[model samples]
Target: EDKVVQSPLSLVVHEGDTVTLNCSYEVTNFRSLLWYKQEKKAPTFLFMLTSSGIEKKSGRLSSILDKKELFSILNITATQTGDSAIYLCAVRPGTASKLTFGTGTRLQVTL
Candidate 1:
């Protein structure tokens, strides 16, 4: 069975602090790894990594995939209190778009 694991299930930080979240997975015929930030009820898309060693970035958020290691990392820089949310990592295996999600990492950014 395919599986996804996230480390540091929860973290607390203050504004201006930087944080890194880790995710590891094992899947057959892996297609892509997706990152999402969940605030309130919906999870917003962050990044989708499909190639090894390539980093994807937007604003203060970035992510990279290490296919050789079967893992990925998400980095948030100068986090603000508004950045407080649950970070989710999911793996898409086979040809289907169906994703297997990790338990999630809850981040709390305070003043």
Candidate 2:
């Protein structure tokens, strides 16, 4: 069975704290890994890591993928209260565009 799992499930941190979100997966013929930030509505794409783009970074957010281990990690530095959101990780199967998403990690940043 192909699945993605995120650890901790929830986290609490103060403003300006750095946090690491972990995602591990098991899938057949994995094509890529995607990261999303969820607030109220649908998730918003944060990063897409493939063989070509193994590492993606923007502002205080960055993510990296490991094809060999079938996992990825997202790092956020200098997080603020506005950064509080649910982080999602998904795997794209080689045969489909649909992504199988992890349960998600809820991050709460206190002011």
Candidate 3:
């Protein structure tokens, strides 16, 4: 069975703080790693990492994939209350278009 694990299931940080979220997986026919943020509504895509070493970035958020290690990490800098949300890590395995998601890491930024 495919398995994905995320660390620090919950976190509380002050505004302007930086955070790092982790995702590790073991599966067959590994394809890609994806990041998403969920609030009260549907989750929004953040990044899709397929190559190792190369980093994907957008504003204060960035993510990188390490195919050799079978894991990925998401970094958020200068976090704000608006950044507080459930961060999801998903992996696309094999030829299936479906994604397997982690339990997610909930972040709360306090002022």
Computed on alpha carbons, the lDDT of every model, listed in order, comes to 0.96, 0.91, 0.94
Instruction: Sort by lDDT, best first.
Output: 1, 3, 2
Candidate 1 accuracy as lDDT: 0.96
Best model per lDDT:
1
Residue-wise lDDT of candidate 2 within 1-111, one digit each (tens)? 679999769999999999999999987788888999999888999999887436789999999987777778999999999889999999988988889999999999998
Per-residue CA lDDT of model 1 for 1-111, tens digit only, reads 889999889999989999999999999899999999999999999999999999999999999999999999999999999999999999999767799999999999999
List clashing residue pairs in candidate 1.
none
Model 2 segments more than 4 A misplaced: none
Better of 2 and 3 by TM-score: 3
Return the TM-score for each candidate structure. Answer: 0.97, 0.95, 0.97
Model 1 alpha-carbon miss at residue 23, Å: 0.3
Error of 1 at 47 (Å): 0.5
Candidate 1 wrong stretches, greater than 4 Å: none
